[model samples]
Target: MLFLPAFLTLLGSVSAVDIWLNFQTTNCRGSGSVLCPGLEPNTCCSVPGRTGNPYTSVTVMHIPSVWNLDCRGHAGNYCGPIRELQTSNGRNTVCLGRGPFGGGGYGFWNGRVAATAESAAEGNCTRPSIVSLGDGTQYDVADLNDDDFNEMILLLTSSFHSFDIVEADGISDDVPEKFNINKLDEASLLPRYY
Candidate 1:
């Protein structure tokens, strides 16, 4: 029985990464943020039910050399189709709400996300190739498995107006940064939906 405890401790020490999702852009400090600490490789790490999909930014830490991160914002309970945010190296404070599907236009994924870290050495996951349509749209195509058929396809629309990319280091949950006044002003100028 004692071996079980030791084994659990050993498993905990083998965790490959840590991920943070925030409701606000540019920072990882907010009431709607969540931290998925000590994530194991090759497994899906989802947002808790209470938090839902209010995430607009993300931060990843301690990425392993053999692992790749895949995060997506879904419009429903299932982790369905959407543009993915993949990174092999650790990232700090990447905004997710500045794109056409995010806050810039449709706001489809402003508050929805599901993430995972998979082992690249396992040969089960392959990065998708993004192709531009040259008509303000693009699509991602990938055959994740070794199968001949393409397994994933995501179409992305582009927005004419661009937003600044927000980056930060070492975010804390205790104190959140003040909301950007310029962004607020820009939001005020946008047409509101009924």
Candidate 2:
């Protein structure tokens, strides 16, 4: 009787192993074809071109936690390259330029690699242009709503403008939660966010 009681008590305490709920049919992906959180796929937003309307391309590289900071100060959390995008009509395709740094701010580029200038120029039609107006000095780009998307804020030597990058098919949804906009300063041999 004691053994039976002990066994019963042990069984009760252990409880029945919860049968793994087979949720294979639960459909984690909502109705949209996009990934979770309702973000469109590869939708890249870009700035207008000076002449023939340059485009943009984007790549995601998980930069090592270290080696993120170098000659360039901490412009963003993860400072890296923005690849230059090729023109749809097959025109001039410049590479993503680099400088002192400023995209969203310190810590914006954390863990992100330089997104190849080629990719940056390709631009996303889905995301809208985030630049508002500017004497074009410095600014911050980020997802104001913190939705893991991106927005641009222009901090020019003369004024400040904020705008959303236009979204494109397969390019719009790749932006980070926020970007440290460091391109508005010093006339250089690089392209401007016109």
Q: Estimate each model's TM-score.
A: 0.34, 0.18
How would you encode candidate 2's per-residue C-alpha lDDT over 1-194 as one tens digit per residue? 67854553354233311100000112211110110111122222322221211211121112123312111111221222322222212212112222222111111122332342223323422232222221222222323442322323111111212312221211223333344342234522112221
Assess candidate 2 and give its lDDT: 0.22
Q: Which pairs clash (backbone N, Cα, C closer than 3 Å) in model 1?
A: 53-111
lDDT of 1 by residue, 1-194 (tens): 89854654465357534443433344333212233445443323332122233345444445444433344333222122343454433332233442111211011112222322112112222122222121212222221232311211111111112311111211121112321111121211110110
Candidate 1 TM-score, true structure as reference: 0.34
Off by over 4 Å in 2: 1-42, 46-89, 93-132, 146-194
State which candidate has the highest lDDT: 1
Note the clash tally of each candidate: 1, 72
The CA lDDT of each predicted structure is 0.29, 0.22
The 10-residue segment with the lowest total lDDT in model 2: 16-25
Q: Which parts of model 1 have CA positions greater than 4 angstroms off?
A: 1-13, 26-32, 48-52, 65-68, 71-75, 89-194
Q: At residue 9, give the lDDT of candidate 2.
A: 39
